[model samples]
Target chain A: MPFVTFLDYAGVAVFAATGALAASRKELDIIGFLFLASVTGIGGGTFRDLILGIPVFWVINRDYVWICASVAVLVFLTAHRFESRYKLLLWLDAVGISAFSVMGAAKGLVVTGSVSVAIITGMLTATFGGILRDLLAGEPSVLLRPEIYVTATLIGAAVYTGADIAGLAPLLASILGFVAAFIVRGGALRFGWTFPAYKGRPGRHPDDIP
Target chain B: MPFVTFLDYAGVAVFAATGALAASRKELDIIGFLFLASVTGIGGGTFRDLILGIPVFWVINRDYVWICASVAVLVFLTAHRFESRYKLLLWLDAVGISAFSVMGAAKGLVVTGSVSVAIITGMLTATFGGILRDLLAGEPSVLLRPEIYVTATLIGAAVYTGADIAGLAPLLASILGFVAAFIVRGGALRFGWTFPAYKGRPGRHPDDIP
Candidate 1:
């Protein structure tokens, strides 16, 4: 439990830094940096908790907020040192999503005892915060892209939940899930791997059909 | 409770219709319409519930899902009859936001006994679904516009919670809250009222400072 918890904090810190970087790019104030960081850090877990009808994790534990705030402040102070802010955001986001998806799946399984819900929770945990961050920045969301972001989370979550269900220890299952998600996402980041866009002829517009 | 419940249902129905309309504009399938409708109908309340660490209203009661689905189906079948899709969306959204805001403030007050939290809950309930709906449809959110949307919700929520804190009966406070929100929002819709955008020089860019 301690090991997984450590990973969760690490992931949240990285996620918070990415959010703060985004805020800096937008020329937002320190308050904006903190807001974006906190939301990006906990938004996915919050969504998972809400959908699964459990207590929100952050409200139950204030440590997450503190960690996010600290990370945001650090990012705010050190942003100018980054050589390539975009690359940092991408890599950090990849690692954060990898860890968060596994954690989300583990919690979902514990709470709901349903594989499908766990998988959905994992995907949401990985992607929803980034989606919200993009929305806040008025940028196109990763969900709208051809990149295999959500797919990576799905694969990792499925692997972790399946391994746990098959009697592997929780820590080992988490590690396996994290590694799998990180590999796929990291590969995509490095190689521009993506899902193929729809190639078929467009359907008649709904207005035309009506 | 009955009156509040009725208002909740009405707000959900209107919100669902707006979501279905967004799906239609995207040329999404029936499943898309259902997904968008359900999310838009319950998303805001869900946010409020999560923030307040309370049970989500829809999870506790399944009727909300049914109502959203029914509204989506109706919208899907009858969308072509509307004289102007955008106008219908705007008017329905206005009504939905007004009702949802008041309901959110009332519930927040009941649950937390904090006027500030209640006001925040109200604003979130009024605006979050629309924000998410725009995100799903890949459009600029209403929050980014210089319209009087969130302002109206804030005004209404503040009035409701303030009135409640002033010892008004719950029902009377709610009526006053609802009427106050609806009138402000409706006036904005009718007269194009908007908050003035920032007219002063922008602050120094963060990068420009030492």
Candidate 2:
């Protein structure tokens, strides 16, 4: 349980860093960095807890907010030192996603005793934060992109849920899920892996065809 | 109480229509239209309930989902016939925001006896759905616009909260709030009222100055 808590904190910190990097790209002020970081760090878990009808984790404990705010401040002071902040953001986001996917599924299983819901919570926890970040930053959403981001989270969540259902040890199952997600997301980052984007055909609309 | 319930349903329907209009502009499929409409319709209330640690209203009732889905389908069928869909969308959005602002504040007051929380929840309920709609549709978010959108919601919420604190009747307070929000929003739609946007100053970076 302590290890899982550590993973959660690490995921939040890394996600906050990515949000701060995005704020920097937008030339936002310090308040903007703090807002984006806090939102991206907590958005996914908040969504999961809401769906599960549980008290929000951050509201019960304020440490998460402090962690996100601290990371935002650190990133604001030092982000300019990076040669390619975008590259750093991608790497950090991969780590955050892998960590959150396992932790979210574990929490869901404990709360709901349902495998399918656990898998979904895992996916939501891993991806919703980044979605909110992009929305607030006015950047393209990862959901709309061709990249293999969501697929990676889905695979991770499924593997974790399956392992848990098969009675694997908790830590082992978490490791398996984290590794699965990281491998897929890392591959996409390194090799530009992508699914084919939808293309509109020139044919008449279905409702329009007489 | 029944009137409040009616207001909630009407707000959801109007918000869903705006979301479907956005999906049509994006040339999305039927599934996409349904998804966007449902998200935009129930999103703000979901946020409110989650923060209040109450059961999500839609998950409990299910009628909200039906209303949103029905509105989406209806708009999808007849939207093309409108000569100025954008104008129609704006008017409907004004109505939706106004109703939601009052309802959100009232719910917040009932759940938590804190006036500040009530005002904040009201603002969230009124604006968050439209923000999500714009983000998903890849349109510039109303938050990024100079329009008096959030201001209208804030004012409406504050007025409602104040009236309730002054021992006004619930129905009367709600009407006052809704009318206040609608008048401001409607004015913005009819005549281009906007706050001045922030302008970046040309100066040396604060951290870089020696």
Candidate 3:
């Protein structure tokens, strides 16, 4: 449970950082940056919680709320020095994704007693927050990008599923899943890996072709 | 019932037009444009219905889905000439907002026995489609704008509530609500009326105060 709390905090912070960094780039004032960041950080998990008929985490736990907001403020204040080296932000985002995905999966399993649903929840927890942040920031969401974003989460879910099936301890399984996702995402960024796209080349428009 | 159905379709078409016009400005292809328009047209109703534990309108009727998509396609085929003209897009958006606000209130009242809840539902139904579209298209959502956007929907919801209490038929109540929202939003746009920021002057952070 303590470990789970750690992951939750880490996830919340990373999500906030992504939003804060993006907002800062837009020249938004500190209040605007924090507002955007807090929303982005908690957005995905809150969405999952809402759909699952649970109290929103930040609302129920003031710690989560304050942490998210504080992280955003900290990031904004320190961003000027960190801006030249942006890799730190990306790494933080990855760690956040991994942590949230693991926590989400575990929570889903605990709440629903269904592994499949839990896995889906884990994936959603990892992705939806960033998707919302990206959308609000007017960036093309990763869903449309040739990025392996969802794939990383899917693989993480699968790892978690496998651990569950093998009767591995839940905490261990979560850790394993998190590591898997983190590595996949980090390796992709480092090696310039990308998913394939249908680049609007002269493809046969079967719908248009009578 | 038949009249209600007519209004719903008209609302969806109008919202779809607004989405298509906005997405076209971003040079999104038909798929992206349609996706945006569909969300703009139905996102609020779907969310409202889902929260109310009722089946989403499009999922239950399918007619709603077809109307949104087909309108989007039709609009896309003619977008080049229209998207550049901001006034045209604004006009379409206003129509969509008005119709959606009315229908939202009408349906909410029909489904829920509480007038206050109905008002909230109406406001959500009128506003969320645009909130969603803005999120998707990476524009600042109208909800966040310093304008009387959502206030108009709230007033319209109130009028709808009054009409319902006054023994007006559902269709008449819906029409009156739509006209109220249309006139308010149209007047705001025409006169460039906007809400002033609530910020107190510089060097005075309310949060920072001892």
Clashing pairs in 3: A138-B138
TM-score of each: 0.59, 0.60, 0.56
Error of 3 at A87 (Å): 3.6
Q: What is the C-alpha local distance difference test score of each model?
A: 0.81, 0.84, 0.73
lDDT, model 2: 0.84
Provide i-RMS per model in Å: 7.7, 7.6, 10.7
lDDT of 1 by residue, A84-157 (tens): 66668778999999998898898899999999989989998888889878777675566765567888899889
lDDT, candidate 1, B1-210, per-residue tens = 566677788889899999999888888889999999999999998888878887789999999999999999998899888888877888899889888888998887787676755776788798889888998888667654544666678777888888888998777777787888888878878887664432222223323523
Q: After superposition, how far is residue A164 of candidate 2 from its true place, in Å?
A: 9.3
By summed lDDT, which 10 consecutive residues of candidate 3 chain A come out lowest? Answer: A82-91
lDDT: worst 10-residue window of model 3 chain B: B198-207
TM-score of chain A of each: 0.92, 0.91, 0.88
Once superposed on the true structure, which residue ranges of model 2 sit more than 4 Å away at CA? A1-3, A6-10, A13-39, A50-53, A58-85, A112-120, A135-138, A141-210, B1-43, B46-84, B112-124, B131-210
| Count of steric clashes across candidates, in order | 0, 0, 1
In model 1, state the lDDT of residue A28. 55
Chain B TM-scores per candidate, in order, are: 0.92, 0.92, 0.89
Model 3 CA deviation exceeding 4 Å by range: A50-55, A84-86, A143-147, A194-210, B1-128, B135-210
Best by lDDT: 2
Per-residue CA lDDT of model 2 for A109-134, tens digit only, reads: 99999988998999999999999888
